[model samples]
Target: MRIGYFLSCEEYAPDQLIEQARLAQDAGFHGLWISDHFHPWNDAQGQSPFVWSIIGALSQAVRIPVTTAVTCPILRIHPAVIAQAAATSAVLHDGRFVLGVGTGEALNEHITGARWPFAEERLDMLEEAVDVMRQLWEGDFVTHHGRHYTVEQARIYTRPPAAPKVYVSAFGPRSVQVAARIGDGYISTQPDADLVKQFRQFGGGDKPAQGAFKGCYAATEDEGVRVAHRLWGTSGVPGELAQVLPSPRHFEQAAQLVTPEMTRESLPCGPDPAPYAEQLKTYADAGFDEVYVANIGPRYAEFIDMFRREFL
Candidate 1:
């Protein structure tokens, strides 16, 4: 199976980000998965750099392809802008850019004072946004009037040699159906055989699926668990932040529920390659062609090496 490294978006020096990408490439990682966020999930999380700029830098520094694990174009930015960014990045990377998108959360989506839509409405907006982006990227004059966006007399003259592939992040049935219908590929954190089958059933074709999992990588199992809790205990449970604040600092309040002990129980942080490889295999077993591993601690390069040595 092909493997990718999920670069941490939480606070880091800019040079560190570039260095991490370079290190991942040197370690034989196939691609890079990045996060898109205006703010870190919590104050303790520290930095959330502009991902596009980082991508631009990675285009020059690394030989591997890069994709935003998922960006919310409809909410944080317009589809036109996203299309342009993707096109530009693809050209810069010599056609190694993929676009992954989702409907997004109020935490990041509400920064523009826009009311967060219900799940169904958000899906509608996403569908329209994707269509608009695709139309604009075809290198033709475009005019679109839909429920969410309207574009007129615009064409992307600097289009890439090939259109960048669009991937959708789906965790629910309706979202999965949307992904199958609209996206070139699908992304999720967990491996679900049913979701893969559903994607094919809905005309998703034989495109790739990508999954992400988080934990700390260390020389000893105990150290890994301790670091995992320190870095990601706040995110241990699913659906806990369906209604949280707008900034990473706010996560600290909720993160109180996530203790070191809880993190050890919840995340796959161990010296043993067994757990890490097993977690990745769940996605592989479910037929994911690629699985991206997101390391939760400071030892980003070390985690990449661990995965490369044991699995790749």
Candidate 2:
């Protein structure tokens, strides 16, 4: 099981992002995962840098592989653009860039003035988007006309020897089935063994699967909760509606239910790295090829060092 970390969506300046990636590599992390968000989930947690620019800097700053933990290719940006960007980044990194993608949420997708598609419609769109991206990445003159996308004699000149691997971010049966059928691999936040089995059964082969969890290396649980709530309190919301809401402010509104007391339930925070390693181990044991850790705060260098000593 490979260990990596999620650069926080909340804290850290642009340069700090690359510096942390460098630190993760120096500490022997196998890869780095970064989130793609147009807006911070809340004003209290305010920082969402353009992730592609950060990837460009990381191409020069670190030797480890980097993946967008999940980017939405179907919306905000066209699949053609995503295909081009991923191809270039993969080439720049000498084939160390993996493209982790998903259907995306309203917070980011609705910005295009397009109505947010229903869940089922979103799945269909993702399927078409993936098809379009793969076609364009092949370096052929693509002339595709699909239900959700259309391309006319489109060609991506700087295609890598092989396209960067496409990893699907899925959390449900339908999505898992789509990932297995089309994706090179699978990515999920929950390390559910059954879901992994479903993906493999559906056709995901022995290719890599990734899992991510949140943790904070702090002196006390209280500190960890403060940081965790500041970063990811919306996990406590009871239903999917809150998650699919149109704006990040809606998340902040729902996250009000996530008190510091609930933070213990949401994150694995402690003075030592044992809990972090233990949580990550669940993903490995579930057969994930890679396990990503999302530090709840800007303790990247320190957490990388401590986690390496304790787990890696």
For lDDT, the strongest prediction is 2
- Model 1 earns a TM-score of 0.94
Q: What tens-digit string does per-residue lDDT give for candidate 2 at 70-106?
A: 8998879989888899999998899999999998878
Q: Pick the candidate with the highest TM-score.
A: 2
TM-score to true structure, per model? 0.94, 0.96
Clashing pairs in 1: 11-47, 41-248, 42-248, 42-249, 43-248, 43-249
Instruction: Kindly report which residue pairs in candidate 2 clash with one another.
Output: none
Worst 10 residues of 1 by lDDT: 236-245
Q: Please write out the lDDT profile of model 1 over residues 1-118, one tens digit for every residue.
A: 7988888777565688888888888888889899887877766567888889999999989989898978898877989889989989999999889999998877778899887788
**Global Cα RMSD, each model:** 1.7, 1.4
